[model samples]
Target: MKVKQKSICETCRKQKIPCDGTKPSCSQCRLRDLCCPGYQSDWIFVPHTAQSDRHSGATVVSQSGIVGGRKRIKDPRPNPKYQGARELTVPRVLGLSVSHLMTLIIRSYVPEPELASLDSNSNGANTYSQPRICGCWVEVLPNLIAKGETVALSSAVRAFAVSILSGGPMPIASLASGLEAYSVALRSLQRALRSACQFRDELAAAIMCILLAELLLPTTLNSWAAHLQGFGELMQLSGPELYTSGIGHKLFVGARPSLVILGFLSRKASFLGTDEWRCLPFGLQPPSAMQQLLSEAAVIPSILERLDKASGLPPRDRAIVDRESLHDFVAVLGRLGQWETYLQSADQYPLSWVKADAEEGAISCRWFNNITDANVLTHFWAFKVICLQNIDELAGNHPGMTSSSQFSTSFRERVGLSVMISQSIGYLMQDEMKLFGPSSVIMPLRTAYDTFRAGSSQCKVELRQCNEIISGILERGYHFVPLFFEAFRDAQFCPMSV
Candidate 1:
């Protein structure tokens, strides 16, 4: 029994590359160093016949025309009505814009079977594949878009998708498209807010998408902060109960870090500091290590709020406020320290702590296991810095409350933590880990920058380093970073030491 050969091999056909019509395997596959799965056997080949088909009125094209013996029609375009027998294919995203391509691709990327594979077992061992940040972008937004429940959400998602597809350092075209989509999303969101028509979950998801767009491609300095304020309002409307399960719960968990930052920006107590928010979002499940750390950090903003109020009081009243705030600050600092110790003691914390760098024969630095670890650790340090600096300020103002020696020690510890953040920059900016994006370091690095006075030598060094990282981030297409830098440049969030 003889078998018929195919015109192309499977590998070449899948790649959309030209295949040399070969029998066993194509030379293109060998040239490209790919294993050639031989041609599929399902196809039935039909040989050319000279006789005209009467059943379908099909006319066979001959090699030669009777006008001239053995003369072929070299160009077939003139015969517009004649169609080829072979199958014709085009690339999936060939004619669509980048944003459209992203929309279609992500929506279909994960099916039920693939999503189920993400459920890893105990001990952090996964027998199946999953994304690094599970269910946030790949799963959640796509699923929401699939439902088509809200236009606001779909538009916001397209805007975010464009940013991700750009892979940082977004081009002018993508930038314009993303901004246009973002504008549509913003308007749709406003309409949704006005009419009070969209479901709480859809509205919340749209707001989350808008917030991410601002972070990725912000038009104004306060856009991210402003959107965060709106997100806070929605959270209030839905209440903590709404976030106890499903998509609402995921958005709340994701928004926690941003809300904590919002507390710093507003210099006011945050809702996240309340017992309900701190404990309820996790529902029956306990908060993860990061979540617990975030809860501890959320308290710092309230301390700042109290400190602000205390500063405005009369001397007698100020003293009373100072003492209470001092105790609160010290306790917050202690809790943050405990969290740090516990994290460092965890097995996963030090996957491979090799020496990453040595600066001028002093102060060796270590790279973290991944961007997640480094980012979380730096954030922990930033929160501690805020608490320690505030404590130092309140104690110094009260003079008799804290000794000068103790103040100096607190000052030195905070400075050390700031330097530690700078040390982690090298690890965070690595190209390999860029999937985590440069947005992770924006708040933490900015916090690290505030630890030193404007004219101090240390301040100059940290400023230059931060500027370089910000430049790298922008070059990678996170254009909104400079806007954040400008907004935070003279921010009065922290009390600078003398």
Candidate 2:
């Protein structure tokens, strides 16, 4: 028979408060408004004694030594006053305070030079412990901090980190520290922006930091949009040439996904759609399959813009405009088709890059070689869905322009793409993928969820999986996802034009 171990929640236990044992959440924790890390009986306290230590044969204790300006006892075991002494329980997370942890995380970034051998030596490596933005922020920010380039970046990064680690409604202390750092970062950012020539790169990085923080702890609905606008302006100021190499290239690449989403949402043409912007950022480096995909996706906004313009025209003029838009849409669709074909035909995407797994129950999932590959695949599916939606919409609005067979084909493809997304959720929601995987899939998952008919069996199943993924995201400190989750939840259809 298993022994029933009684225990209080970790928070209450840490605080040394009396806990009225409860399931899910204890009364004390609920009263304090803390995100209580649930109950566990993993700890065992034993009175510190030579006899007990000898029996355990694990810990070695010195009989006498001066510690913290006090002469140690020869043997506290023999003293009645020290009879109740016990070993201190070490915290699972190594750090006395949030500030200390932040310092450790900031200092722990592996610069590019140091990370060189990682690829060769990374077999069975536990990369989960490394910082999330390894090649981008992790590579650049630490070096900048060391050189005293900017203090605000460091504080902003810390605030963002704290928000992620806390996982849910932050404790009072964690919230205070995060807000304090955030305030300091904002004030410093104001000064830096005023002197843009001196702190151009720093200004861009600082804005990114604010955007990241706003994702999880948003001040208002427009806060992220406002900050994103600033980032885009910074990009314009920096120009494509500036990002041709080094730290500039990394920053540009890091900021591209957000910029792409912004372009689509705004339904306006952007510089990202231009050939110069696509080719220049890579410089001497060969663009990855992901980069190539982004290049194709950037043109989507221009298509949306054309479609928007066509809608405002008179019927006769609209028909002419529709013909031009339809041609562009088909061209983009062909390009995406070629992209998919290239991935299969190219030597870069090895067979080992993706793995297929059997579904244990309701959740069917596939695993990828890494987070980047997973991101690329999900986004690919989403982009295809959007493109198809646009193509069908354009075709449908002007009758006889597009064949009925084309609509049937597009419908079939959309259904298949949604299934692919639903299956991939299992791997994407894993704890190890939290840093990059979860946030990257929000839009794709939303797109996938929208592909199905409402109240149908397929739609209900997809909705459940999406909800589970969103819950996992929130539980892992991606509080920003839920805000978007609510907005997408009730929507009957995706506004592809919007």
Compared with the true structure, what per-residue lDDT tens digits does model 2 show for residues 163-244?
A: 4333223221234434445666777778767766743565666677667655555354366766786677668766788887
| Candidate 1 vs. true structure, TM-score | 0.69
True lDDT of residue 261, candidate 2:
74
Q: What is the overall TM-score of model 2 with all chains considered together?
A: 0.70
Q: Put down candidate 1 lDDT per residue, 341-428, tens digits, no spaces.
A: 8877876546335484566734345477654566577888888888888878887787898899998898778777777877776666
- Alpha-carbon lDDT of model 2: 0.59
How many backbone clashes are present in model 2? 0
Error (Å) of candidate 1 at residue 208 is 1.5
**Superposition-based RMSD of candidate 1 using all C-alpha atoms, in angstroms:** 17.2
